[model samples]
Target: MTVKMIAVDMDGTFLNSQQDYDREKFSQLYQVMKQQGVRFVIASGNQYYQLKSFFPEIEGELSFVAENGAYVVSEGEEIFTGEIDPEIIQEVLTILAKFKQGHTILCGKNSAYVNEDEPDSFIEHGQKYYHRLKKVPNLFDVKDDTLFKFALSFPVEQVPEVLVQLHEALGDKVIPVSSGHGDIDLIIPGIHKAHGLMKLQELWGIKNHEVAAFGDSGNDLEMLKHAGYSYVMSNGQPRVKVAAKEIILSNDENGVLLKIEELLGN
Candidate 1:
């Protein structure tokens, strides 16, 4: 493989069910990639802060395409950000207010905002993915921060229905992507994991063929098609698997790392 950049999705693609990866092995791989001038990009629907926090030691050496491509940070610098129109956000909030079930999150650059009226379970779950979380009286009353994506955690069955409703109501204003585990994110239209990768590709003058990507869900479809070389996790969504150039071991098997080793002849 003639790759200059490697991008990996977080949840089911790279991190095991324990919400973590093998640091020692990954650190070693990081060293080798750095030596070979391969840019390592962490692309996910997760918050930027949470994503970077996982790789504290090598964070400055890596790039993050977070919030499902609404935000991009490279080498410790903010490269780009996609913002949702305030009017559109208001429309979304109105729709969500009628949704009795699930928790709504206003993903912002400063922090992930939630309704303080939420139960303890919601707060705890929010904390897991958001490092800097704020509990406001109501998400509607908050408007100080620049927002990127809108997220909801509800029943898996509701995902498809809600997404269809959102599409019908909002049209191309916003898009929804599942982050697995009954979590869905509404991001700005035309922005996704692949958008972030393309930004990095342009900045580094690397072509699509020079980038290899790994992902495991519907949100990863665009990215899989964007990369010249793309791998879908063995446990990936059936739809996504159809688009990948190849299939790899599950996340628990350290497939990303193993694939890298094979590619680099380690």
Candidate 2:
């Protein structure tokens, strides 16, 4: 199938376990894609700043669907921005405080906010994913910022119960999407990577049939199903694998770049 735009998920689909990719190889592939008029988009639940840092050479030539789907940017321009009500954000902060969710981060358009009391481990990890993070005395006091989503971490075993509690407490305000590993993103309802892709499609006048996507895990399910050509990494969860049109090599193998090379070669 002919593809006009290609979107990829970051965590487990493009970056490997250590969170690095073959930049030189990707640069070569991107040159080919640009020449063929194929748009490149980074679809990730991670912060837009963090994701953009990965593509320094061609950052302006691409698009970003970050904070799940709360923020969408194309070619250095903001296409869409979804935010939660201030009252609802306060409620979420209360609930998380009750749970002692020290790993929770209040993501905003300008920067991500984390508790100053959190462990150093959390701070270190947060720094890697959120380039512009602030240590706040209290999340409730965070004002004058457009909040996007909340990023939380939990033990793999506790995720299910935590999700149920979040659902019952938050009701329809938030949607919890697993971004793989122990990370869970609490995003605003009706906002997701697919919504970001839809925005891009409208701007570029492209159809789902001409779009290709790659992802792996809960948050990626919608984007995968939305694209005509969807691929899940072999290292992805079994359930996620079924949602894609085909399975590819693990991220550590640079499966995404390999597949793109094959597609371009054809």
Candidate 3:
């Protein structure tokens, strides 16, 4: 099967906690992929600003599945957008606040508002990698219209119950996805990784058998299961491995780059 498109996740699948990337290897593979007419779509739960921060130079070439499939962009143009209803967001926020007490993050297009600041690797990583990233102490101060994602982190074990509660509260209005941390993500209705990636395929006229994907979390499962040739990182979650068609080396091991090289050689 010929792979005409590749969709990859960011945090665990591409960037490590240190915010460092295998730039040289990735650049080389990107060049090869381009030469072969393969389109690269970045599929993640991150907001548009967050995704653009990583590869600012490719704003024109890259397509994105931002806010966990709530939005889709191809060639700097929007192909689809599924924003959560404002009322639903407010309701969900109230429910989350009740459970979280003081540890929730409400994200807009370009910023994140928090109930209380907590120490997390994501906070530090944002400081190091993002330009003009801001933090708000409360969601009450946040104005809507650009709201995209609501991410919250609590004690790891609390996640299962928290997710169930969110599903119960939001129902079909929003969907929950995980970033593979203790965090849970709330996105607009019908917006999942799989849906967004499939949209990308249709936009580019690429068939399911012509698509490949790489990811490392529970959030990545749907697409990993649906892609033509899905790959899970060696360090990825066990369930991700179960869903993937193949297993590659860890992100730190330049697994994606090596695989791309093999694909090009063949």
Q: Could you arrange the candidates by TM-score from highest to lowest?
A: 1, 2, 3
Identify the runs in model 2 with alpha carbons over 4 angstroms from their true place. none
Candidate 3 per-residue lDDT over residues 1-266, each given as its tens digit? 58898888887887766655777777778888898999888888777667877777777788988767777888888887775567767787777667743256666655656544655655664443234355667566567446767776666777777778778877877677667667678776656888998888777788887888899987888888778989999989887799998999888877777776776674
The sequence of per-residue lDDT tens digits that candidate 1 reaches over residues 1-266 is 68999999999989998999999998898889989998999999988889998998878878999999988999889989988888888888997777787789899998999999898898899888888889999887778888989888988888878777767876777888878888988889889999999999999999999899999998899999999989999988888899999999999999989998887678
Model 2's C-alpha root-mean-square deviation from the true structure amounts to: 1.2
Model 1 regions more than 4 Å off: none
Candidate 2 per-residue C-alpha lDDT over 63-147 given as tens digits, one digit per residue, 9 for 90 to 100? 9999888999998999999989999998888777766653799999999999898898988888888999999998899988999
TM-score of 2: 0.96
Candidate 3 whole-model C-alpha lDDT, 0 to 1: 0.75
Clashing pairs in 2: none
Q: Give the TM-scores of the predictions, in the order they appear.
A: 0.97, 0.96, 0.87
lDDT value for model 2: 0.89
Off by over 4 Å in 3: 115-141
How much is 25 displaced in model 1, in angstroms? 1.3
For candidate 1, report its TM-score.
0.97
Q: After superposition, how far is residue 145 of candidate 2 from its true place, in Å?
A: 0.7
Measured over all alpha carbons after superposition, the RMSD of each candidate to the real structure, in angstroms, is 1.1, 1.2, 2.7
